[model samples]
Target: MITIQYAIIGGTGVYDSGVASIQKTVNTEYGKVEVDIAEVEGTSMVFLARHGKEHGIPPHLINYRANIKALQELGVQHIFATAAVGSLNPDYPTGSLVVLSDFMEMTKQRPLTFFEGGTDDVKHVNMDDPYCGNLRKHLLEAAKLHKIQFKGNAVYLCTEGPRFETEAEIRMMRKWGADVVGMTSVPEVVLAKELGMCYASVGFVVNMATGMESGPIQLESIGDMLARNKEKVNKMFLDIFSKTLDQQNCGCADSIVCL
Candidate 1:
C-alpha cells in the first residue's frame, strides 16, 4: 500500500509523470487508477494525469469519481490541479496563469459525488468556497518566489467538452462572471471536497475564447503556446508542493457539514 498526502492532477499539455520518482497503478472500487509518486525538495507527492498519460480521455468522459477515490484511498490530503483554459476575460490574456477561486458547473452528464449510497449515505458538502483558500495562498507564494506572473483569483467556467465552446457560449460564460473557461474542473473539484481533501486549481490561459479573438481559434497556436510555457508551469508546481505539505490548519477537512 503506497501512502501519499499530496497529489497533483495534471491536465492538457501535462500528460505524463515526468516528475514522479515511482509510478504504479492502484485498483479501487470505481476502477484501476494509475499514479506516480515522487519526492521533491524533501516533500513526497503523487501525480495523476487527469486525461491519462496520453490525453486519451475527454473532459466529459473522465472518471472523476475513480480518480478522486483512488487518491483518498492513498491517504491524499491536499490536491493541486492544473488546467489549460481559454480566457474569457480580456484582461487575462493567453500565456497568463490564474488561480481558480470558484467555479460554475455547466456539465450536463457526469456523476458529481461519492455519497450516492452505502453506509456513507448522501452528503451535502459545503462549497461556499470550493477551492481551498489555504492552498491558494501557498500557490500564490510559490508563483511569487519563481517570479511567475499569475492572477491571484479567477472564476472558472467548467463546460462539457471534447469539442471547443461556440462563440455564443463563450459570450454567455463571460457575462456570468467567468474569467477562464475549461472542461474538466467540475466533478474533480467537488469530489475532492467530498473526501475531506483541500483542493485548488492553477489554470494556464492557452488561448482566447471563441469570439474573443478577431480570427478563428487556431489549434496549432495553442499547442505552440503551451509548449513554450510548460517549463514555467512545472516550476510553479514544484514550488507549491515544496512549500505546502501540511494542511492541518485548513478548513478543507470540514467541508461536509451535513449527511
Candidate 2:
C-alpha cells in the first residue's frame, strides 16, 4: 500500500532507470498494470510504462482509462507524461525537447472520456488550457538551470495509430498550428484533467515529420536516437519532479463544473 504523490506514465524504454523497483501489478477495471515505485530525493513516486514493459502496447491499444484510474486510486495528484514525437517545425529537430502547452486531438476510436458508463452520468471536462501551467513553468526553469536546451512551448497534435502519419496529414496539422505531432497525449491529458490531477507533457523529438525528413522514415534509427537521448529526458524529469512538488496551487490544480 505505497502512497505516491506523482506518477510518470509514458513509453517503456523511457524509464530504464536501474533504480526503479517494481511494487506490484495493480488490477483495475480495465486491466492489470505493473506499477513501479521509486524514491528520488526521498520522495516516493510511481512510474507506469504506458506500453507494457516490453513495449508491446501500441498507442491506439493503450488502456488509458484503466491506467489513469489506477493512478488516481493510488492518490497521485500530479502526472508527467513523455512521448516520442515528430517535429512539424523545422527548428525543432531530433533529440530536441518540447514542454507541450497545448494539444489538438486527431485521434478517434479510442475511449476519450471517463464519464461514460451504465451508472456514471454524463460529464464534460473543460480543457481551455490542457497542460498544467505551474508544472510547465517549473520544468522550464529547471531546463534553464540545468543548461538543457528546451523549446519553451509547443502545440502537440495527437493522432491515432501504430503507423506514423502521412506527409499530407503532417502538412494539414502544421497549417492548423500544430508544432509537434504524435500518437499519444490526447486521452492521457484529458483523463488526468478529469481526475483533478495537474498534468503536463514532455515531447522528445525523434525525427522531423514526414516530408521534412531526408529519405524514408527509419524507425529503428529513430529508436536509437531516443535511446541515446534518454539521459537528458531523465534529467528533465528529475528536475521537474523535484521542483513541482513544492508549489501550492496551479491553474491546473483547480477544477470546473460540467454543464
Candidate 3:
C-alpha cells in the first residue's frame, strides 16, 4: 500500500535505480506489475523495468496497458522513462544523451490505446505534446541544477522489435525525420497519454543505426552509454520529483476526451 506520485519506466539497459528501495506488486485488470518504491527527500517514486527485470520481455510483447494501469492504480501522476536508442542522426553518436522531444510510431500488432471501445468508453488522446512538455521542462531544470550533461533534444521513432532493423529500413527512417530509433516507446507513450499521465523520457544513444555504421549491430557493446549515464539520469528524475510540481504548466492531464 505504497502511495507514489512519480514513476520511472526503464528501457533497454536501465534496470535498477541505483538506490535503496523496496519492491511491490500492483494488480491491475490487464495484468500485474512489479515496481520498486524508493524515497528521495520525502517524495515517493516507483521504478518499473519496461523489459522486465531480466530483460525477458520483447518490445512488442510488453504489456503496456498493464504497466500504465498499475502506475495509475498506485497514484502515479508523473512518469520519467529512459530509452536506449540507436542514433540515426550523425550529430547524436553513441554515448549522447538527448531529451525526447517528439516521437513517430512504427509499431505493429500491439494495443495502442486504453480506449478500445471498452467500459471506459471511446476516447481520443491528444498527441501534440505526447511526451509531456511539463515534465520535460522539469527534467531539463533538474539536469541543469545537478550539472548533468545532456547533449540535446531528439525525435524518437518507435519500431516493433525483438529484431534489429535492416539497412534499407534505417534509410527510410532517417528520411522520416527520426533522430533516434528504439523498440519500446510507441504504445507505452500512447497509453500514458490515454491515461492522462504526465510522461517524459530521456534517450541514451547506444549505437549507430543498421547502415549508419560500417559493421553489423553488436549487441555486446550497446550498453556503453547506458552504463555511463544511468546514474545521472536517475538522479535527475529523482531531483525533478523531489520538488513541487506545478500541474498547470501543461495540458498533459487534459489529453483525454470523449469521442
Candidate 4:
C-alpha cells in the first residue's frame, strides 16, 4: 500500500502510458475505481481514466463521486485532469491547449456533491475558485519546463452530453462568456473540491463548436486531435507531479462550509 498523494484523471483519448506500474482497484462507497499506481521521475502517481480505460463511459454517466472518493481513499491530495473540448472563442481554436480558469455549469441530472445529507450533516462547498489556483500555477510552470505551449486560459462551459451542442446552444453559451465547451469537468471538479483536494484541469480544443465553423463537427478529427496532444499533456502532468508540492493558501482545503 503506497501512499500516493497525486493523481491524473485522463479524459477522452488520454490513457495510461507510463511503465513499471501496478494496477489497483480502489473500492469506495460510490463504486470501484481502477487506477494505475506508477512512478514518474521517481514520484509515485495515480492515473485514472475518466471515461474508463477503454473510453467506454459517456460524459453524463461518468462516476465522478466514485472517482474522486477513490482518490481520497488513496490519500491523494492533488489532482490534474485533462479534457477534450470544442472551442467557442477564436483565440482557442481547434488544437489549442488551454488552462481551465473558470467554469459555467450547463450539466443536469448528475450528482454534484459528496455530502448528500440525511445520515451525514449537510455542508456546502465554495465555488469561488472552482479550479485550484495553486495547482494551476504549478501546472503552468511545469508546462514551461516541458516547453508546452498553452494559448491562454479558458472558461469551460460543461454540457450534459454524449452529443455535441447545437448552434443555438453554442451561441448562447458563447454570449455567457464561455470560451470552450465540453461534456465533463463540472461534477468532477466540484466533487474534488468537496473532498478538500486540490484539483485543476487543462483542456485540449478538439473541434469548433457548432456554428463556430462552416461545416459539421467531425468526430474523426476530434480523435486525431486528442491523439496528437495526449502525450504532451501527460508528460506535463508527470513533470508537475515529479516535484514536491507544498501546502498553499489555495482555499481548496478550507472550502467546505458547514452550518
Candidate 5:
C-alpha cells in the first residue's frame, strides 16, 4: 500500500514519469489505472499519464474515474494537472503557460460523476470554485520564482475530442470568454472536486486556435510545438514541488457534502 500526498496528471508532451522510483497499476471499479510513485526534491508524489504512457488513449476514452479514484485511494490531497492547449484568446500566445482559474465544459459525452448509483441519494457537488485557489496561488508563486512568464488566470473550455475543434467552435469559445481550449480537463477537474481534493491545472499554449492563424491548421505543428516547449512545463512543476507542495489552506477537503 503506497501512500502519497500529491499527484500529477501529466498531459501531452509529458508521458514518462521523470523521477518515478516505483510504478504500479491500481485496480478500480472503472478500470485499471497505471501510476508511478516518485520522490521529487524530497517530496513524495504520484504521477499518472493522462494519455497513457504510450499516448494510446484519446481524451474521450481516458478512464477518468479510475484515475481519480486511484489517487484518492493513495491518500492524495492536492492534484496538479498539466495540459497542452490551444490559445483561444490572443493575449495568450503560443509557448505561454496559463494556470486555469475556471473551466467551461463543452463535452457532449462521458460520465461526469462518481455518485451515479452507489449512494442512497443523488450527490450534487458544489462547483462554485472548480479550481483550487490555494494550489493555483502556489503555482503562480512557483512561476514567479523561476521568472517564467505565465498568465495568472484563464478560463479553460474543454471540448470532447479525438478531433480538434473547428474555427467556428473556437470563435464561440472565445466569445464565451475562454482563454484556452483543450479536451481532457472537464470530468477530470469535476471528479477531483467530488473527492474533496484540491485540483489545479497548468495549461501550455501549443498553438493559436483553428482560425487564429491565416493558413490551415497544421496538425503536425502542434506536436512540434509541445516538444519544443515541454521543458517550461517541466520546470514549473519541479519548482512547485520544491517550493509550494505543502500549502493547503483552502476548503477543498470540505467541498464534498454528500459522500
Candidate 6:
C-alpha cells in the first residue's frame, strides 16, 4: 500500500474528469474508500468521490472519518475538497465560488475528532486557521491565472442536512458571519487538521437559501446552477491540483506548532 502526496475528495464532476487512472480501494477504520490515482503534469495525484462514484450518498451520511483516515494512511500530504453549498449572504449570489477560510459547525451527532478512544491517548489539535494557508495560496494563484471569478476569506457554516435550510435559518447564519452554508465541511476540515494534512475547500454555491430567492424553494433552479458552474469548477480543480503538486515545499507542509 503506497501512499500518494496529493489527493482530492469531491464528486463525479471532478472524479470523472478522465484525468485520473482507476486505482484500488483502501480500507480504513471507518470504511473503505475508492481512489483513482494518476499523474498530472508530472505530479502524482489521487481523486476520490465524496458522494460515491454515482453521487449516491447524502451529505449527512458521508463517511468523513474513513475517508480522511484512508487518505492519511495513503500518505497524502495535502488535500483539496469541493462542496456544493447554499449562499447565506445576499452579496454572494448563487453559482459563485467561495474559497473558505473559516468554519462553524451546527451539527451535533457526527464524530468530529480522531482522539476519542478509551485506549487512544488524548491529544489537542490547534485549529486557529483550519484551512491550510499554503494550499489556499496556491489555489488563489491558480484561480487568478485561470481568470476564475472567486471570493476569498469566506466563513463556511456546516449544518446537519440532506435538506436545505429555511429562510430564517439562513438569516441566523448570516448573523453568525457565515458567507456560505453546507453539510460536509465540519469533520472534513477538522480531520485534516488532526492528521496535519494541508486542506482547502472550494465551495460552489448551488442556490440561494430557500427564502432569499423570489419564488418558493425550487429544486430545478439549484440543479441548473450546478450544471452551469460545473465546467469552471472542474478547470479550477485541475489547475490548483497541478500547482500544489509542483510546489512540494510550500508552507503547507510545515509544522503547526512552529507557526
Best of the candidates, TM-score: 4
Rank candidates, lDDT, best first.
Answer: 4, 3, 1, 5, 2, 6
Better of 5 and 6 by TM-score: 5
The TM-score obtained by model 2 is: 0.92
Kindly list the per-residue Cα lDDT of model 1 for residues 1-259, writing each as its tens digit. 7678888888988655456478778888999999888888787888899988888989999999999999999989988888989898988988788899999988999888888777765668898879998888887777777787786588999888868889999889888999999999999999999888999988889889899998887667666767666667676776776764666767778888655
lDDT tens readout by residue for model 4, 1-259: 6688999999987875645778999999999999999987788889998999988999999999999999999889999999999999999888899999999998888988888788776799999999999999987888888888899989999999988899999889988999999999999999999989999999999888999999999767777778778888888888888778855769998998887
- Lowest summed-lDDT stretch of 10 residues in model 3? 217-226
- Winner by lDDT between candidate 3 and candidate 1: 3
* Candidate 6 local lDDT, 1-259, one digit each (tens): 7768888887435456557486768898888988788877776777888888888988778898998898888898778888877777777777688899999989977888887757665566677768887778777887787787786567999988877788888888888898888899889988888887888888887777777877765556655666566666666766776653543544444434421
Model 2 lowest lDDT segment of ten: 246-255
lDDT (0-100) at residue 205 of candidate 4? 92
Question: What do the candidate models score in CA lDDT, each in turn?
Answer: 0.84, 0.80, 0.87, 0.89, 0.83, 0.77
> Candidates sorted by TM-score, descending order?
4, 3, 1, 2, 5, 6
Question: Stretches of candidate 4 above 4 Å error?
Answer: none
lDDT of 2 by residue, 1-259 (tens): 6677888876736867555566777888878878888888877788888887788889999999889989988889888888888899988877788889999988989999887756665567788878988788777877777777776588999999877889898889989999998888989999888888888888888878888876767566666766766667666676677654743656555555654
Please identify which of the two predictions, 1 or 4, would achieve the higher TM-score against the true structure: 4
| lDDT: the better of candidates 1 and 4 | 4
Lowest summed lDDT across 10 adjacent residues in model 4 is found at: 12-21
Candidate 1 TM-score to native: 0.93
Model 5 clash number: 0
- For candidate 3, the clash count comes to 0
TM-score of 5: 0.92
Best by lDDT: 4
In model 5, which regions exceed 4 Å deviation?
Answer: 219-224, 242-248
Q: For model 6, what is the error of residue 182's alpha carbon versus the real structure, in angstroms, after optimal superposition?
A: 0.4
Q: Judge candidate 3 at residue 185 and give its lDDT.
A: 84
Off by over 4 Å in 1: none
